[model samples]
Every structure is written in C-alpha cells, then in structure tokens.
Target: MWYSISNLLGFGADFGPTTAAGRLLTIGFWMLSLILIATYTAQLTSFLTLKASKSTITGIDDIKNNKVPHSRIGIVIGTSAEEYFLKTISQGSTNYYHLSTTQDIFIKLLDNSIDVAVASGASAIYAINNLYCKLTLVGEPFYATSIAIDLPRVWQYKQSLDVQILQLTESGELERISAKYFNTLTCGSSSSDESSSKKMEVQSLAGLFLTYACVSVIAILLHLWLKLKRHL
Candidate 1:
C-alpha cells in the first residue's frame, strides 16, 4: 500500500515487498522449490513455454533482432532460462530489459509492446499446435531443460507416488500426455551454447581494461594540470 499511499500523497514510490517492507515472501520460493522437487521425483516436470500474439515473425533472428530485441525479451524471473540468459546473454544482471515473467511477457506480446516470449520450446510448440497456431515458431530451439515433477526429499513414504509415476510412464499414459501436449515422443536434447559464456568473459575483460585505461588517463591529466597550476 505504500505505492498507493504515495500516489495519494502525490509522491512517487516503489512498493516492492522486501525484508525492509516487513512482509513474508519466501513462501513463494519454498512452494516453487517444493514443486520442482516433486517434479524431479515423479518425472513430470513442467516445461517452459514461450508465446507470442503476433504471427508475422518467421525465425529466431527476427525474434532476437527485429522482434524481441535484447531489451525486450520477457521471461519468468528466477527461472532456469532467466539464469542462463543472465549468465550467458546478460552477463548475470537481473535488469535485462528483455526479461520479464511468462505471464507479463504474453501480455506485452498481446499489446504489441514485445515481440515474443521465451519459454519451454516444448510448451511453445504445444501452444502453437493446440491453442495459438496463429503465431509462428522461430528456428530450432536454442536450449532445452529436463522436465520433472517436484517431490519431497524424503525417500520413504513417497515411494508409492514414485511407483505410480513409473507405472504411468511404462503404461504409455505419460507418453500420451506428452504427445498430446508436446507433439513428440521424447523431448529433444538441450542445445549447447558455449559461445555466450566466452563472449561474456571477453566483454568483461574488455570493460575492465577500458575502465582502467580511462581512470589512468584521467589521473595523468589531473596530475599534469595540478603540477602546472602549482608553478603558475
């Protein structure tokens, strides 16, 4: 309500809940972590899905350059893709203009504010085949992550659930769901993008070198000006 209060008072304010804000927020993290763990155990993990409202774009290049652009790709915060994008694409900064939550990204795409959403390619294909065929999927997927269901770490009582998941997998029930949703028998292997890391490292070194050179030049100029002033 701080944002509301500030607006009422004619002052700009940010009201993000934080430790300073005194509201509990870790529950979301815990719940998400629990879900991931369950998926891991049951092997029914959720896949990330990228969706776009507009249909004209044809390929990943269009999405990366003309459509989504570096400053406008939307992704779920704290997700695997976000982490990879930061490390490989954004150099570990959380403030990439291209990134946002999956939902907000879709909304942005619908509003024509963003070009595309980055999500599980599997999920994207599913949406395209079953739901949003109007939007075209770009080139081959850039990466893939294993999908799994979250479960508690305890190995005793969850055995029954594990057995059930295995039974479903063997009975082809899980495969049916996969085919229905994913249009494939098995998920594709994740693409290996090592160039991103190498490029980031190179850029970081260049930035450091440039900063050091700039500071050195400034210091030399200042010293020279001070010495001449002393004589004058």
Candidate 2:
C-alpha cells in the first residue's frame, strides 16, 4: 500500500523487507502496480481517441428536450420518422430538416448538418452495421409498432397465415432470421485492429496474485514463529 501510493505520487518509497517472503511479495506488488497503471493508461488513451464527443445526442428524448437544436434533427420526408417527429416531437410544426433519402440522413450527420436522424430501428441498424461504420446506434427505439401484412377483407387463408406466423415465432425461427440480418457486425467491431489491442485481464495477473498470497502467508507464519520464540 505504502509503496504503491508513494510510487504513483512520485515520492521515493524506502520499503526494506526484513524477510525473504516479504521481499518476494514486494516484487509481486511492484509488477501488479505496473500492470494496473499500464492497463489504466491504455484504456484512457483508447477512450480519448476512439469514443464520440459529449455533444452526441443519445436518443429521441434528447432531441425532444432540445439537447440538440430541432433544426438539426433530420427525418426522411415520407418516413414514419417524420410523422413521429411532427406528431410527437414537433407537435404538427415542421421544425425539422426534411431529408429525401436515408443516405442523406447519414451524409448530413457526418457533414455536421444534422445532429439527430430519426429513422426506423431496423433500417438504421442495417445502415450503421453495413454502410456507416462511424455512425452507431445510441438509444432504444422511439416506439415499437407491430408489423402486419395487409390481407383482403374476405381472404380464406388469413387464419392459416396467422397460424404459420405464430408457429414460426414460437419455434424461435423468426428471431433467428431477424438476428441473421440485423445482428451481423461489420463496422467498428471489437475485432478491428485498433479495438483488438491487448489490455490487462485478471487472468493475466493470476499467477502473480497467487505467488503474492503464498508469500503473505509465509511472512505471517514467520512473524508468528519469531514472536513465540521471543515470548519463550
């Protein structure tokens, strides 16, 4: 404790070990401190360089609360997103940047024209994972709506279609299909070179910790033996 504190604070620590086990533990402690500091520095550097800035808008609520200017909020003119913004966010006022396509939403986001892009979850995730590596999803969906297929008013196969869809869902086939499409990572994934850089793990220092524990036990035993001899 004293040595680590002194070293970290740039003060000289004169820790003189009176026993061999204590000396061994001192070496282990030194290595442990080194790894801790190295790991901390690596994590800090990664965060400062790779992470997004604080001005990043987190979700629909952030935009609604004016964390970003409403004008900077981009929505495709014909999308459900624009309808949501107009009805729920803008409250019938067209206080948003009307983008004509999904591509424009991302382009404007990158070029600093828009701070928030209102879009469907699946489309946004697909774009981010497949096309825009730099743009990542930050928040939960604005609202969840049920998906349905429009059937004729007097369709005879309606009951059969519903049964088959329910069977697929119950069998987990629907979820598996959804995952196959939406969950495949292609951008800014941890497998990338920058993110894959090695950092300290508990297992990396496990042997050192075990050695220190043994040295601590030996030191305690030696001290007890010495005290007993003096009492005798």
Candidate 3:
C-alpha cells in the first residue's frame, strides 16, 4: 500500500520488490499508475482550459449581458429560475423562450432552438451526469442556494451532521462520489464518439491479476516439489 501510494505521488520508494515475480508485478503496477495519472491530468487540464474560453457563455452575468440573445434563452415557465431571469436578466420582459419543464432545456439545446437554459444548477448537473452526458455545467452555480434535509429545529445532531458533511467535502469523498456517477460518456460527438475515455476498470488489469495468480501457484508448487526432492 505504501509503495503504491508513493509511486502514484511521484515519491521515490525506499525499497522495491526483490523477487522476479514481484518485480514483474511492480512493473505492471507502475504502468497502470502512469496511465491513470496521465488520463486524469489530461482531462483535468482540458476542462480547466475549456472553462476559461471566452466563446463559452459562462454564467448569469453573460446571459444578462446578452452574450446569447434573449430569444435564444430557455427558461422554465412558472419557476423561480424564470422569475430570477425575468427580474435580473430580461428587465421584466417576457421575451425569453418559455420552456414547460426542466427536460425542455436539453431538448431545446439539442434542437438548436436555444443557446442557453435557465434551470437550477442541480437539475442541470443531474441531467448532464445521468441523461445528457454531452451537456455540462458552464460555470459555478449562479444564485447559489443551500439544500438541507428536513431536520427538527434544535436538533442535537445537527452540528455532527454538518461536521461529517464538511469532512466528506474536505477529504474529497464528495468529488469521488460525483465522479462515480459522472465518469462515463455514453453520448458523444464526432471525436468523442469515436474515442470516449473512461476510467480504468478492473477488467483492464486482468493480465496483472493473472500474472500474480500464476506466480503464487508456481511458488506453492515449487515449495512442494522441493520438499519431495529432500525426502527422496
């Protein structure tokens, strides 16, 4: 475990496997680590750079500034999001496209009728992660709001729950949880359609597992054979 962690972090290991089979296994592990790290780094960098591009309409501010025409923006009618857009973005004019449901966001986006969609960040993210893998968050959630479980006021465990949630965020468990659901790109376009990158699965490391299994069996068999030789 120490060796694996150190290798991934680029720290020099104090010692390495001495046996031939152990060395072979270590080599395979090194290769796997490199591939995993490279993929993660490349994708992270790509996302960050894309986030900075001016061509992308980022947040509510961009919409208010008319980066996309008001007619091209889709807002779910009768939603607080629509109200906010009307009051803040469109100056009380109902010129923006009225969408019937959150689902209309993706439908309008894909159909080329809308350049932007006004919906809760959570709803948009959920759609992007589960249903519409090609769709994505443009910027930090605007009009950020807190969501909470319905706990009784003066609840004794409230502090404890808050602490636990904060710990999850600080330790990156939240991001890991998010990644588990959001990692796949089943719906893709052109280049991504041809080659969608996915996290390394256990199946991809079958060769390494097979090698270790074979080595363990060989070692056991050799031990038994040596015992028989000594008896003879």
Candidate 4:
C-alpha cells in the first residue's frame, strides 16, 4: 500500500493500490505532499534571500576568526566588556579603540570608524533600541555579570534596600524594565515592512493548486475506469 501510494505520487515505486482504502490514502498523500513541498520551497527561497543581505557576523567565534582588525573593534573604557576583551580576546594587548561612552560606540560605527563594539548587554541593547536603530548585537554574551548597586560601608537601610530589590525582582518588575529596553531592539517592524512589500497573494499559489486539482481529477477518472473494467 505504501509503495502504491508512493508510486501514485510520481515516486517511481512501480506499484498500484489493490484496495479502495489504499487508493483514497494515496490521493490524500499526494495532496499533503504538494502542499508541504510548495510551502517549503517558497519559505526557503525567502530565507536565503534575507540571509544574504544580513550581517555575516553571528557570534564571537566569527569575530575571533575574522580578527576584524584590532583598531576597528571599539570598547568603552572602564567597563566589564572592555576588561573581558582585553584579558581573554586580545590577551592583554591594547588593540581595541577606547571610547569614552557607550553612545560613542554607535556613532563611530555609523561613521565607519569602528567595525564592531563590545559593551554590557543591557547598555548595548538599550543603545541599539533607543539611540541607534541601525546597529545590532552580533553574538552571545561572552562575559556574563550580575549588576549590583554599590553601597557605602556606613550606609543605613541596607536591609531595607535589599528587601525592596528582592520584592521588585520577585514581582517581575525588573524583568519588565529590562524587556522594555531589549524588546524594542528587535527588527520586528522591519520584518513587517518587508512582508507588506512582498505580500503573497492567492495568485502566487494558483498554479500549484491548479496542478494538484488536475492530478486529482485524472486519478479519479482512472479509478472509475478500472472499476468499470472489473465489472465488465
């Protein structure tokens, strides 16, 4: 039955269904295969076209292997990211361009002074969202660090502050605040724009559906002819 179904779908299985149920199943299989193949081919073409225009730098490995020219890599001085790159990536070598502030990172990138920049994930995402919509984060975080508030040794209300911080975190307020910053950095609206510009119409799949319908009609006719021949 499986071989007959495969053959009916033009898979060259060299068999035909011996039962009515098998013939019905073959028709269903053909319809399903047609839908799946059409959808996959359309989506794959769209994906490849978009990927070609996107940045080649996906992660830190690409950065390390490409060596993007030391001078072109920008880092804000006195930050954890700067320390990580210096100690781990550059091996204590002063190869990266030092920026005075996080904002400078995007400015230099836009002007083509720097090819890439390393900054705290929060600050980088915030900048990309609010200040520089054109800039994008390339890789997974290399040096993950917890953010903490500094308190003086003699400061009072330390316990109270800790309790409030815990309350905020537990209540999901901290997550909401972080999400507000990072969520805006996504190119969702841009994707919508592309989709709108290249919107698929019913006409786009008309030929595919037409071909399936024709094949279905032919299969039904053949089935009817065989049944009449058997009776004769």
Predicted structure with the largest lDDT when compared to the true one: 2
Candidate 4, 1-232: lDDT as tens digits = 6564564455746666676645765775666677867776787788777767676667777767755877888889998888888777888988789899988988899999998887775867766756676776666677787777889987789989989999999999999997887666455443443323364668987876687667667777777887898999
After aligning candidate 2 to the native by TM-score, how far in Å is the CA of 11 from where it should be? 14
Root-mean-square deviation of candidate 1: 26.3
Full ranking by lDDT: 2, 4, 3, 1
lDDT winner, 3 or 4: 4
Order candidates by TM-score, high to low. 4, 2, 1, 3
lDDT of 2 by residue, 120-187 (tens): 65767788877887676767776875566888999999999989999999999999998999888778
Count of backbone clashes, every candidate in sequence:
19, 0, 0, 0
Where does candidate 1 have its weakest 10-residue lDDT segment? Answer: 190-199
Q: Model 2 scores what on Cα lDDT?
A: 0.75
Question: Candidate 4: misplaced stretches above 4 Å?
Answer: 1-52, 186-202, 205-232
- The whole-model lDDT of each prediction reads 0.53, 0.75, 0.72, 0.74
**Tens digit per residue, CA lDDT, model 3, 1-232:** 7886776566648998775555655665666667767867887776666545424676778887788888998988987788788777777999989999888899998888988888864656666756776565566566864556898999999999999999999999988986766454445442342224454568876876676567657755766776788799
User: How does each model score on TM-score?
Assistant: 0.45, 0.58, 0.43, 0.59
1 or 2: which has the higher lDDT?
2
Query: Model 2, residue 158: what's the lDDT?
Result: 93
